[model samples]
Target: MTSAIGEPNAIAITFFLVFIVLSLGITVWASRKTRTAEHFYTAGKSVTAFQNGLALAGDYMSAASFLGIAGLVALSGFDGLIYSIGWLVGWPIVMFLIAEPLRNLGRYTFADVLAARLRQTPIRIAAAIGSLAVIAFYLIAQMVGAGNLIRLLFGLPYEAAVVIVGAVMLAYVLFGGMIATTWVQIIKAVLLLGGATLLALMVLSRFDFNPLALFAQASDMYGASVLSPGRQVSDPIDAVSLGLALMLGTAGLPHILMRFYTVPDARTARTSVGYATAFIGFFYLLTFVLGFGAMVLIGRDAITGIDAGGNMAAPLLAEAVGGTPFLGFISAVAFATILAVVAGLTLSGAATLSHDLWVSVVRGAKADQREQLVVARAATVLLAAVSILLGIAFKGQNVAYMVGLAFAIAASANFPALVLSIFWKRLTTAGAQSSMIVGTVSALLLIYLSPTIQVDILHNSGAWFPLRNPGIVSIPLSFVVAIGVSLLWPVASEARRFAELERQLHLGVESADELT
Candidate 1:
């Protein structure tokens, strides 16, 4: 079947080939140094703040942000701004609450931080499950997005596209480790931001460089009612719930948090986050322009008739603005964006399974670096396979919806434990464990019983779980469970140890050589 945008342009294909080669070369070069598990997992804790910041942007701005947000804005006007605000607002929480403590406490994963003041095995197991669940959901979403984009741009079969993405992403994580993945994200971020800026400028230029007029025109195009803040829909409850998930979810994400570990110290971690916030905020503001650009310039009828997935809006707008060559460039950029994100997710998942679960939990402190890297590589391949299968099974579903589900789970399961582990003095092993379990299980069960799963997955239309996202209910539930469980089973020994570790995590810094 031919793509709605016509055959993939040769320029786009050529650009894609060049990217694939460059990414592969970087992976090969980085793999040589990935002899130790520390190098493989955290890039030897050597990445600078600025470099890590750009890479963080690359990891954070997945296909959902790049393609999904623009499409949502083009489709729903102010409703799309909700996603932008949700995503952008979460960074402040990371910068102030989570960043320094996370950097100070953890060695490899978020599990490292939470389990620092708790038992190693059970906490590691629970956190690993949460991390893996979130990672798997995220990976599936990226894989599905990649397949759809490939089909849209190049007229490839869905299976073939999934295979290609899987192979490339696997190579990236297996050979490159954090170093290769970090560079890939950096390059992709630069291109994505550059392309978005260009597109935003072109869009603004179309209205003679007037921002107000552009919005006014967009309001007219989408309808004057849409311009009103509360005019789009009657139900703000679900909107609020979804927003909570996206906003808090960003800080809780394993991949985003893992980026901080690669940097040198808490100060650099904070600096990197600041830079990421600025970069991401600027980019999201441009998304508002680009979204409105599509609404007014491309028109609703033209885009609605295309794929309903909404991933194609940016590429389609590029074609409308700059002809085939520019469209090709945007398409190639989108493809590279998916590859970079998948690499990050896969690496994080592999680290959790290999380092936290296997070496740290199963093997204890006795396992050597060489043994851990081997387990990490094996886990990487396994994760890639599962994601590819899920992607193929769930093709053509809404990318944003799946990604939102992942966020909901992350916010519910990971956020509570992480926040409490760092700040609350009364937090015990029982509290952290119960919170993780309740949050993870409750969110998953809620999703399983949701309308999407019942109607779409089970082919039963009558089932209704009114809340599309579980964040509203499950987040509070997690906190409650943690606190309640802690009171019921108080551990004075655990509490004292937690206080001491908290002090060290907040103030103590080992020598640079002590890290490795």
Candidate 2:
């Protein structure tokens, strides 16, 4: 399955170009409809629940889910299922606790929800910081996936592949905004799910259409240990930490939270989550089969020889089952997956900068629609550049592993503040700010000291942080700080507004002006 030395794959290249051209066409069409800040950030709040569900699923089932998790399963066996389970469980938390309230209270970003009942200035600043950090880390994982995928499939240099992805993503967000990004995600989602389903069925047909038989074959080939838990999460503490990050982090993802605003009302927001959870859960099931299929059909030696991180397993598996044209289709789907997810991330980051920071803070919510739109586009370009550099800098890391770091930050920083703001009264602006700042800083600092960085990347002999993920410690610390600060420094005004916030949360926003 190895590509020739520095030679482009003609089939893959043709498929990739076709996808690019089609996506750009969609973007051009969307740009014509994108004139207002509402349109730019939330697609005019006009997306139906079904379309938004597909879009949300598209955003969640990213390169990390499609390529990284499949590769992890191929490499680590049963331990890789942990990532899938962790991510899937978080949707219920979003559906029940966050999604409806988020849509009703906030207009553009999560900070809007927080600022609904609290002081705007400090809250927006802290939230923007937390959000941008999460987006940055998540963006790195996606960009890394894109770089490796393009390099392997198209024979481009890794840096060049990264640049191409960044440039294209920038165009989507800069012009078409959420309208374009949403449709791109929808298209990518359908293609990815179909490609994965087809690939999984092809593998299962060889094993009598019974998934257990595929697992059995994998067990026989790699030994029974491959069907059981292995060393990837050998330490109890690390297992708990990673679990907390993956499960809770999904509720905190800025781009995901932003999706609720694209839908019309609170009820639609909840419905969309229901649809998304179903799609995502099914997709994850297919990945389990796809992973084992790769291990049994392609063998570990061939899989690892192609890419040490095992990121190429799914595409390689596609080729094994269906040959070169199938490989081209699956590879293009992977590229589309990367592009759509990064576009969503970039748009969310732009919203935080333009709506939360620029319009709300810098101008004291005085900026016109035109100015806000300009700032958002400018921020998109900035984030795209930063993401491109980050992708090149962290060239060879396993993207799934990189995403875990992002989840840790999200769980620690964004999740706690958001929950406290919506569910806990007596949460002062000071309390929310402190929680976000502490959660973000502690998670990042611990990550730097963890083995993933101190040893793996820095070449140090030992890591100061014992666990690979800081979620076990950082998540609780964030909650504790938030509770302590609220209890000790209560704000009567914020507490009073909780009653009004509650009314809006359940009853929905009454006026059109409220949404704007």
Candidate 3:
């Protein structure tokens, strides 16, 4: 069956091109001011709390949240809400535990935080590996989503779609750096929120602005079971594992963590998260209405007929209620969503490569601002090319598993090392390094053995691993390893270093000038 959107749609093309042009304009304007390493990496720490807040919302709310959740809820009813709740709950974890200290202690990348109290070279390497892994997996998901989405919406070939996205994303990050990326995210967020609000309002108007009435109508068509938990999450243990990954992963995501540096200080960082939480939570609520609206207005048969994954439900609903123009608008919004996210991911990856690996490791942290900026741009180009290739290579595969794997890795590897470094003064260099390595390796190994890859992807009859996501085991195991290793291998001098770092985290660093 061919998708309804699997043809050349002129309206969709126009909307998408307009977005690309506008973003490029912003990148050009930003490039002029992107002179120093700080400007290139953290927008010179010049962005206001409100702007960073919108950018944070744009970074966190991906195409998955916009189209995936709406489709999931449209298809699976109450069970679909699980994904939304899992993602939303993670923000509080970020707000309370991560945002301030991260803003205060780090200059550009999250590795700076870990390097504060631990051995610089080894800690940076470990942290860089974890950051790159998360970025790679997350980038794959965004790239694949972009290729497939653009193919369906604009009738572009999959390869061409990916290259286009990569090229534009490179232009944003490679030249304009964080400044351009942040504004791109801010614009996309506003468009997305506005589009979703309009879509939800149109959906609710059909039932006189009553969500329950829409639910009743959907239940009448699909039966009462649609109003209850369904097959979206059948396994109790797998559900818990997935929940753990989603809850903890947000605090560890490099792109999300990188946003804190774009703000001025720790207090503004907290404000950004608060605003981000409000925006994200409200958007998810609108997503609920959009889901039920699709179920009732468009019907399951129609949605599934267009796209078997039900991903077309939101776009189809837009077309059904508001005709082709609105569908074009929503489709363009979805594409913009992918572009915004990948830009942030690409920037994070570049930071790990340039700031952490090149400047800090190879150059012994002696590289000047000019050389560092050059390496950063070069790294951005490299990552962009890699992303385009990966998207084209994984064209028809089920890359959904990669998204979950990314979250699991973030939870296991990055989150453990970060929390321990910040709070546990006794945590030795060996303990931190071991925890990150073990966490990263264990999560990857378990997922490879799990039913997700073994039976589902590889078509094996049975599997050694029981759960789909590794978070249930990997997260706790990481913490245990960190604590146990710290106890056994005590480092006296490291404890004193933590005292100094803790003071800086509590007070403030003042500016990027004070970082070095």
- Model 2: per-residue lDDT, tens digit, 300-373? 88888988888889988988888888888888899999999999999999999889999999999989989989
User: Which one is best on lDDT?
Assistant: 2
Error of 3 at 9 (Å): 1.9
TM-score of 1: 0.96
Q: Can you tell me which runs of candidate 1 are displaced by over 4 Å?
A: 1-4, 229-233, 455-464, 512-516
Writing each residue's lDDT as its tens digit, candidate 3 over 1-516 gives 233477777788899899999999999999999999899989999999899999999999998888888988999898888888889999999999999999889999988988988898998899898889899888888888888888888888889999999998999998899999999999999999999999999988889989899989988999999888778678898889999999999999999999999998999999999999999999998888999899988888888887677777889888888888888999999999999999999999999999999999999989998999999999999999999998888876654567778899999999999988888889999899989999999999999999878998899999999888899999999999989998998999999999977889878865557775
TM-score for each predicted model, relative to the true structure: 0.96, 0.98, 0.98
Per residue, candidate 1 scores C-alpha lDDT tens digits across 1-516 of 123375757989998999999889999999888888778878988998889889999999999998998888888888788888889999998998999988888888888887778887888888988888899889889998999889878888888999999999999999889999999999999999999999888888888988789999988666785555554334677777887888889878999999888988899999999989988999999888888888888876667767775667788888888878888899999999999999999999999989888888888856777788899999999988988898999887778878888899899999998998888878888889889889999999988888778877788865657667888889999999988888888889888988778666787477434432
Model 3 ranges off by over 4 Å: 1-4
Local distance difference test, per candidate? 0.86, 0.91, 0.90
Q: Tell me model 1's lDDT, rounded to 2 decimals.
A: 0.86
Ranked by lDDT, top first: 2, 3, 1
Superposed on all Cα atoms, the candidates' RMSDs to the truth, in angstroms, are 2.0, 1.3, 1.4
